[model samples]
Target: MSMPPPNRTKSAHRSPALRPVGPNSLMADLDLPPPTNPHVQPVLDPIFDEPDDHGGPVDPVVLAAAMSNLNMLQKQRSNPHSASSSPVDSGPSSPNFQNGIPLAPPMSSGNSSSVPGTPHFGAQTELLKALDESTKVIRQNSKAPTRAPSVSGIGAVVEKPDYSEAKIVVAMVGLPARGKSYLSNKLMRYLRWLEYNVEVFNVGQLRRTKARHEQEAGKGKADHSAKFFSHSDPKANAAREQLAEESLEMLITWLKAEGGNVGIMDATNTTIERRDKIRQRVARDPNLQLLFLESVCTDPAVIAANVALKVQSGDPDYAGMSREEAERDFLSRIAQYERVYQSIEEPGISFCRIFNVGQRVFMNLIQGYLQSRIAFYLMNLHLKPRSIYLSRHGESIYNVEGKIGGDSDLSERGWQYARALPNLIKDNIGDGPLEVWTSTLQRTMQTGSFLPFEKKTWKSLDELDAGVCDGMTYEEIEEKYPEDFISRDEDKFNYRYRGGESYRDVVVRLEPVIMELERQENILIIGHQAILRCLYAYFLALPQDQLPYIKIPLHTLIKITPMAYGCDEKRYPLPIQAVDTHRPKPLRQRKNTLENTPILSAEPDELVFQSTTARDYFGHLPPLSVGTEQVQEDVSADTKLPTGGMIKTHGLGLAVEPGALKEALERGQETGELTPRAIAER
Candidate 1:
């Protein structure tokens, strides 16, 4: 089926310059067409004329229908050369406008005035007045914005509802190894990130564990194998059914205890009988709602890839076995289930059915905020093999001086790295129409300027906001506000700067970006360090505490290939040496001495050496480092470095207090550096 092109309409609430114009208005400056018949008079009147109703109520439904006809006539079929070209002029001669309803007032203009038997000119005026009133009501209702408030922007006022009591059960339905566990984990991670209570109970894992134990202990008379997957085998079917029931019992128990608002049962609930059994168990819970998510795959290549991933993952069923034997056994298991696997077709159930890894999605009776959010995220996911490449923007002017945040353009060395990016991409991804994404910042845009691929900009990909600390070096920040400096180091992920955002806040904003990335293919993301960290942590499944410390160095590219088992990672470093502008904590002012004492100079001696490797011909050289054990012995004769106790900012210098810095550090240490995440959970 083909859909007609959407009928685009100018906003009725737009500025006066773009508002709808009437024939009698000043916008009539445009030449009106000649009337089709010279004998017939053209009806010209304003959309709103004299007031006719004396505060009498008008039926909104009838008024709306009339207004719709007027809109359609003006926009679709009416011609400017016709006699009734005016939008407001629905003349009595037009049969389509007459609906056997009394639209005009009974009193004529002449009857109200001193003259009698005069024709009514106020009839059309009354109709226009009623329409004008209806327009106000329609505009008021349509003014409400439908899009959810963005997690990136601050200062937005969104009305949040209490969904704590709304519980959901998502039952998985698909053949074996159809990516059910993968989908379950992804949904769990996203919901938990949103601070919602959620959990996943995989029935296959329970069955696998049971099978492994029975085999090891030599307890069961029958072994679990392909025969156990048969629907016609009575003894084998009983064991499988028992395991499924156990998983459901656990889910129901958890929901009843309010352990979570969302619970997922991950398994191959392939038959109608199995789905009905699970539904009947949860039907008694008035507060709980059930949703079935069925994944259908017909592509043999996708299935083979998924099965290979499963074998490599070392499922307990494949324990102490050769790779070839394990692969064969898993394949046989799938073949047995395929003989009797039934697709979801229950008419009264709320479900989302996905075909061929999200190529086609059909939903029935799905609604509510949590359910809708789940459906939307699922629509973006698939099991196709692809890799995501991530890179921080090349060195910017801010980076040269160790600044935290700024939209400075790329430096001279940064430009060299940018020019070399296209060739690097060609080497890794080969020649293809790859998609490139960058932040709206100038540095990111400049870094990706040399790439020939199509480029797009995302505001959500912008660097994390440092707020007041933006464009300032860490040394300067420590010298001016020593207390804040200590607080940040103690717990970098959750310590939101004064009027600034934290790492957790960055994750919230990157949710939409991640969803879109999941839907795309071969995307190269040239973004900022903080934004990239959030994305990298999501695919890597890193802990929240370690997210802030993931080293995303400039001039290095990270590639991530997601599989059923885990994500494969690789880092390629470009052999371009740039200045290391990273700064450490400042020395305590009270001690008036640097810890691990060693004399240093403001400017060190430069090294001139010849490269001994053939790779040096292609501009590749080993990095240089300076370390000396004799520095302490020569301290008396060495030049002393500047204290940097006072930093210059906006033409003013402020010295940090040593005692205050010490107190802050001690306080953080005593608390075990509990981050904002810990605090929020508490």
Candidate 2:
């Protein structure tokens, strides 16, 4: 029996610019017919227009019918150009991604005893070569990532039009106590993770700062009583408007001064007059795109939660007041704003209304890649409380040998840690539906082998690919590729190896994984060090540039709970002995000054020199579960050395931080100031 093919038609929210303009494109010159344009947009799609109940949930039956109509719109006609074309890709359309969904097929890592990174179903060299000549014209002008090029720029004689260069200003809309700030903060984090220069300016914070300044000067009374928000109070209203203006001015100044990509004005622009004032100001700048994001929550339970959160967080307005009094006063203030709050009937301005945190979404007049991307992201949000547990796979034979990236089975101690994992998780997570996730590597899978929960393996979770250097010790790498070693140390985040990937590349491939994690509830991810570091950086909201050096020790688990405006994190290290593979950021030293470099030794009898990075490969063993002492150090030297570990293996899975191992060697290993055997016996 044959199953139905997935829908490949365009959604109402898809950008019109994505349509094929065959008449003027390079396709016209090639005498090839353009892909058929499926104008299957339905009038009832709330994303394009408005939903009934004025931005509430759409009728489920109607939504289902619209989706059916969309899928039915795919015409199964023959392509006049190719006679062998099947209905799999009817007409002239490409079979690949006519739909926006990702199409990653299963991959097999061909015979490799060592750990395998994401595999390829087959080679793509010939396919890449076939497109080289055809794509050369458009490839001549290289633009930055995330910037879309115009059709005229593709070597066609079409009219040259202005390309998109919109500096967006996202203005918040809703009554006080709504999740406006929550949505703003999350959006800022997501955009930042994607390498966009985004910033947020909260109007309430501005007003609070001004009040504190006046209090310090003792020039005016600091009054934030409920009366301050009353619609009838002209004086307070004027002050609020003034503060809003100041925040907007700061956003504009930052965008112009720093050449920012997205700037947000976080405030309750609830009234029609307030939204209009914002539009008038934004219209003055030719390239400034204003998007009003309205968060509408009718659920009393959600509203109550938001109110409680604000009051307990010690909102500056409720400072020095009891919880009861603060809650009472804040509710009164919300009442005052509610009196004048409008449902946002803006005539021509682009806006989106999120009802009950994406139970339903209504977007109107929103176009362009950036604006639509923002709306799409908003559709995935939820206010539910959930925690994501992250852990690196336990110790492997590669870790014992100071090698990186392999699918080797866990060592004896690694198996011990894996066995203890379920209890540690059960103790912390305590009785819930927790699924287990791992990379498609033997090490990660073995680490989670004991887990009694639903499990999944993601190729995207595979360790960083080392390209040409897969399975060589760090010492061998420096000796063979000195300049490449230095390049990695200098820009760890963006430095792509000769044939492998960069931290930035890993971030790009992990987009789907991140989106899924955001949508899920409780899940435990047992992954590689590089993979876990990337996930940890995202949950902690660390800067992307710092991702390469995040210390994710083996056998330690991290618990990350999502919050309304941020994430709360905690770390738990098990009573398991694992090799210390941490390497800090290295010092910037010129040639001839690169001293005290650590070199790897397969046996205690051999020594390699001038390696420019260090690790005690045959000296210090993994830490003990109980404690460290002189006796254990002596035992480690005699027992752990020459324990039949593999040699000359390379990859970045368990490798020391690129260059920081040099600094560590300089400070402790070479100088003997903090030797491995320094615990009362050096």
| Candidate 1 Cα deviation (angstroms), residue 600 | 34
User: Among these predicted structures, which one has the highest TM-score?
Assistant: 2
lDDT of 1 at 593: 28
| Residue-wise C-alpha lDDT for candidate 1, range 1-682, written one tens digit per residue | 0011112233322222211221212234556674342222222221321123321112222222322333342232122211111112233443422442113211122222111111111112333333334323322322323324442222211222234566889999887756677677777767765546777888766665554444456555334556667655655565676677777877877887865788899888876667778888889787788989887765554455455555545455555777567667777787666655655544456677666666656554454445645765676676655788998888888888888888887776676677667778889888765767778787886677656665656667888888778889878888877876776765566666545667766665676577667777688899988888788777765545555655677888888876543466778889876666433323332133223211233322211111111100111112212112112332221122111321111110012232433344345335643222221111
Could you tally the backbone clashes for each prediction? 0, 7
> Which TM-score value belongs to model 1?
0.59
List model 2 lDDT by residue over 295-333, tens digit each.
Answer: 877665456555656666646777789866876788778
State which candidate has the highest lDDT.
Answer: 2
Once superposed on the true structure, which residue ranges of model 1 sit more than 4 Å away at CA?
Answer: 1-166, 192-198, 214-222, 254-261, 308-313, 318-332, 579-682
